[model samples]
Target chain A: MTRTSDRERRRDPARIALYVFLLASAAFFLLPVVVVVLNSLKTMDEIRQGSLLALPASPTFDFWRIAWSSACSGIECRGISPGLFNSIKIAVPAVFLSVLVGALNGYALSQWKRPAADRIMLAITFGLFVPYQCMMYPTIVLARTGGLFGTYPGIVLIHVVYGIPYTTLLFRNFYAGLPDELTKAARIEGASFLQTFGHVMLPLSVNMLVVVGVLQFTGIWNDYFLGFIFAGNENAPMTVQLNNLVNNTRGEVAINVNMAATILTALPTLLVYLLSGRYFVRGIAAGAVKG
Target chain B: MTRSKAPARGLSDMPESGFRPDLVAIGFFLVVALVFYGSLLWTGYLSLTNSRLIPSYEIVGFDQFARLVATPRWRTACVNLVILGAFGIAGSLALGTLLAILLDRDVRAEGLLRSIFLHPLALSLVITGLAWRWLLDPVTGIQSVLRGLGWSSFHLDWLADPDTAIYALVVASIWRSSGLVMIIMLAGLRGVDTDIWKAIRLEGIPLWRAYAQIVLPSLKLTIASCIILLMADVVRSYDLVIALTKGGPGFSTDLPAKFAVDHFFGRANIGLASAASVVILGFVASLLVPYLLIQRKGRA
Candidate 1:
């Protein structure tokens, strides 16, 4: 204790430097966000005249309102409002379906004792690494042929297909870690596989479910590429609309509106992160380490 | 005795009820195989054909691959990917590890600092690119701000210049990803047994040497995971390029993913786009196969 106090009392240059470095890095990370928020709050004239890093002289929510309702994204000037609802519509169902399918697949794979199960698991895991571009063209062709392309259900299916690998991996690993005795005990109770899963495994999977659900929600919500290619114009997510609004070369460039739209697009995932950060971190760590 | 007999009976009877689960598993496997592997094969086949704006069944052998190689835009995209991968991976890993180490020292406001660092990861790459683009925009952004502060010589027009636009991407991606790496590394650091630190302290080994020779080496898997994740991010980096540079100033920032999507949809050259996609898959496979094998070996 005395030594610890002595160490704390000493002004270690190295420690001070370390703190400074960390703080600087934190500032660097926060710089873009701060700039965007300040610009979002400022008027266009203020943005044009003032420094990008400066606080707004008279911050207002007007840009946010415009970005949410009136700012032009592309051909239409409906702002990101349509895209916001589209995203929620897409994300909620996608998350629920993917989580359900993943849980079932994971539970089944974990319980199965066959060597073929391992091979199937390996294949599914490999799907996690395959670039979406490789599959984009064919999936488009397939979707078009099936008359599902450019539809809401089409987008949801795409999300589910892509999401299955990740969600399955998470749940599979989680279930695999459970003691085998649980399954054996359930079997002894004359529970069928589905019944065992419904009665025992799922009830025990609230934590994993939240982790997977939160991860999927944020992932699908933040997705721009998938949403761009798969969601079509009417079903485009907020990210796509936000990009269109900012990059629309027509008319006067409203930097404030663009920044506001960017913030608005980012808000859902940011809120998810802030609210369930523990689960988010857990999901990321699990994904990285396990993958 | 009855309970023990019942356990054996349960084991014997399990397969009767297991049929449905097995069927479910197989159904999913078939779907994955059909969609994932089927798409890969389809793309590979398409790459070999002369499909343009439509599916052409006539195989031109390796002609599309040759064209893909010959195309300067495609070549630029490939090279840009390498540059982004090399710099982005190394920068994020180094910076993230440093932040992780700093945070591991039980610093005050660690959670606050961590959240600040990590908040970026929650954002879409579009938002990240736009925010950075705004900050790096010369006329109205950092350069003008710095000049207004009397720096006078501040000039950062990287986004506009073809030669430096890729570096701007590298910067944004590193900023967006390093926080994730930091959290992963911090987890790894926390998992390190305290006994190792105790021994190091007992030996009076220098802290840097301890980390260099001892601590990081033990976290090889953690480091490998970080590299894999970052590499994947670099390879499939389309949103950032589109949002930031738009492959602008004559396609300087185009990634292969962007290249493929453009050729397929924008340029209406299906064969070339499919070729690009195949090349990307090959790149991913090259990285993933070895990692998968290593993981299998580790498990064994």
Candidate 2:
């Protein structure tokens, strides 16, 4: 073929436009984030004075310091640090219980293949589809009636119940790919259900356990609704303060504080993600491959 | 406490201590099933009644559903969800495919760019809404900044505008979900055979044409799965909307999941809420049934 003339090249303007369109689309995707970072480094006066694209003359660290140590969330002056502990308190136990339960259920269903296992799994799978909002009223009612309302135990148990499906689904499919021969051999030697699982299965599931742990941790820690509902005033998680800071922003709306609070609220979870991203990718890939 | 005895957790599951196969375990699973299904049954019953703050024994008999149907907010939510869902799924898929294709081109620093895009995935995506809220809110955000900067003509306040708030949510959700879509499509693209590309190029097909004709059509299964996942996600989307707008500017951005939540929590109208939830569940089941049945029929 002959080399294309300038007219022919120019005739493909739509193709060039596609590139521009895509670049604009990508920019759209990043716009809010760009606004966040830009506003973060701006002084309050500068933020109040101009376009988000404008740079601050003297960008101050003051907003971040206030957000971390002193930004008021309700009527209180203390920041979200206490709520951070509360999230850990709720999330850690919740993760432990849910993962243990989900793993046990997954192992039993997949390996044991008990009668009605398929139906049972289907029903639970359906449970995952149930709008969590639908369950919220009942959960709150149950919590209140059980005298567990606005308590740590209530929040933890709520997380466990809601979390059962995600963890169980991941592990069930994962354990399905495990070698059945090991469990079979253990059973043939008269090893019982608990022993076979404890010895033959659990040791081989370290990577899976970490993945499950990270997922549950993210879900629970990131949660705002359950935390808001059940944690009450004293036990509210970091997101609660994070919410109030953004929503109210003291008397006037403080853009810098909002960004700082967001960064602070997201820090722990982000740190976990950065540290665990490799393992998480590997785990999900392994699970998907097995499926 | 009495049952806490260390009698036997052994592999053999000795008969005396109630092994895994014992009736106790069976009873345990039954209890779990009962509790799981029991609440749902109760919810269904509540939907048929006039329960508000507390559950009443009175049966109102589909009144809530009727009311829910006539409610303007419900209609808006349903419509808003469709719009948001369509834009979100299409936008994410397009971005994901483009990113995957570009990254697959033996590009340098592909991992770094991929990670930057996917880093948003790492953080709890609740922040997506919050971050966007900061960017879009009229008073403290970009629009205000632009106004102060002598570009007083700038008008971009989607988060607070009743008409455009849903699109704001769409933007945030697409940001949060694009990485997952990219990963999925990348996997699909990598699975394509290179021989076809070589063959197509030899036949004078441009790379773009080859991708469109060969690679794109082959990605149908991935696209289908992504669509289904996105549908379910939109149906279940509560947190981001709740964080950003709280279904406000007078419920313009209200989604069904949020509708169900506000009734269930803030409003304390369980009967109305449960009825709405049942409607959603029914819609899901209907969609699922046709596919599964048609698939079964096709197989048969």
Candidate 3:
């Protein structure tokens, strides 16, 4: 007992050092977020006069109000409200359509033993790595030709198209893991392809759907490049609007308002992460490992 | 639950009379082909032309490619991509692995610490950049804050200095991405066989040596996955640059993706942008094809 206690005493300093290091690293990760949040609450005067690390002397929601409703993003005095609506409008349909199509495609690919399935899967995997810039010009031309460029449907379609690789991957891997007897049973019941998917497969995919949907929602909401290119001035998403608002160099910079807008723009994904932490981590792991 | 009630069908027994699911898969395949492959071919063709403002499609015999190499900014962008990829991948992987190992120990508040580390991954890169940019701004950010705290000689203006600005980008990116690497590595660590730990303990192996020699080598696939993912992020990085520095202090922080976008939209040099895009595609393909081949071989 004395020997073991002596060994434990010897190890105490190392254990303390490990905890110290972990805590410091955690602080490093949290610092930027803490600063952003603290500054977002401070008045411009307080921000300029005081240190960034200090607590706000006089906290207010005025900057958030301005960022949400009235701060100028580019030429428009209207703030991120319009863009917020546009993001929701775009993300809802895009997530639904991408997830739905992915479910269908994944179900088909996994259950069917067709010769083309592997090749198609290979193509989709290739799609995952192809930089968006590579496909941007042609997609622009295609969207313009289809009269879909700068329109709501156009942006949604683009998200779905780009999102296909990830969503299909998640669902395909998931469906592949289930017992083969599930699909066999569905087929034996004389269910049509759509029927089997709707009644048998999709019902079983609620957890995966949540995972994929949450991921897609976060991605679509946080997207700036796609929205900048495709959403046009009238239909720009919150991310694009936030950039315009913060980066606009014409007027005096509103640092507080920028921080406020930054927080607001990040709120949805943050909320999703907070609520669905388990699914989010799982989705990320699944997506990363497979991809 | 009812799976046992139905007769098990052979793997080859695809239902024939129903609506064809294969057709749906085929349709998706066509869309992927038209959007992905068709774009690739078209971009490649455009790179050989002298199209400007609009795609002229005159086939100027590699003029755009020649011009792309001649552009100094393109050179800078290419060099910066290498720097970002090398530093960003290495930094994130190292930090992530450290955190993973640290967390692998039975620490209290593991969930809270993991959440803190991983929360940044949930936020957009734009948000990540803006937050970092604010903190790193010398006049109004951490420098000033530190000065206010009586550290009068403190200085951090990397965002504004062209020479050191790319390192600022690297720092912000590592900050944003290392969490992801940590999570991935942590998962890999969890999967390490318990017997290995027991064997190491029995042998009285130093923990660091055990990890470095035995555990890490066994996690080759996990490390490879992390590298590939980080490389993909490096190639596709645009939002972070735009949000943080906007390739600022005279295009010092320019990356290939930003270079392509600027030429295509801001400069209206479609042909040149297409060449740059093709180069980016080539970079991705070079990385991906070999990886894919190896993955296929492994599977086989």
Sorted by DockQ (best first), the order is 1, 3, 2
Point out where model 2 deviates above 4 Å: A1-34, A282-291, B1-35, B144-154, B194-204, B286-300
Clashes of each: 0, 4, 0
Residue B173 CA error for candidate 2 (Å)? Answer: 1.2
Residue runs of model 1 more than 4 Å from their true location after superposition: A1-3, A6-10, B1-10, B13-15, B297-300
User: Listing every candidate in turn, what is its Cα RMSD in Å to the true structure after a full C-alpha superposition?
Assistant: 2.9, 6.3, 3.1
The C-alpha TM-scores of every prediction are: 0.96, 0.86, 0.96
Candidate order (lDDT): 1, 3, 2
**Model 3, position A230: C-alpha lDDT score:** 94
How do the residues B1-300 of candidate 1 rate in per-residue lDDT, one tens digit apiece?
011334334566555555356787899988898889999899989999999999898999999999989999999999999999999999999999989998997788988898898888888889998898888888998899999999998789998899998999999989999998999999999999989998999999999999999999888888888898899888899888888889987999989999999998989999999999999998898888667865765465
Query: Which candidate leads in lDDT?
Result: 1
Computed on C-alphas against the true complex, the DockQ of each candidate is 0.62, 0.34, 0.60
Docking class of 1: medium
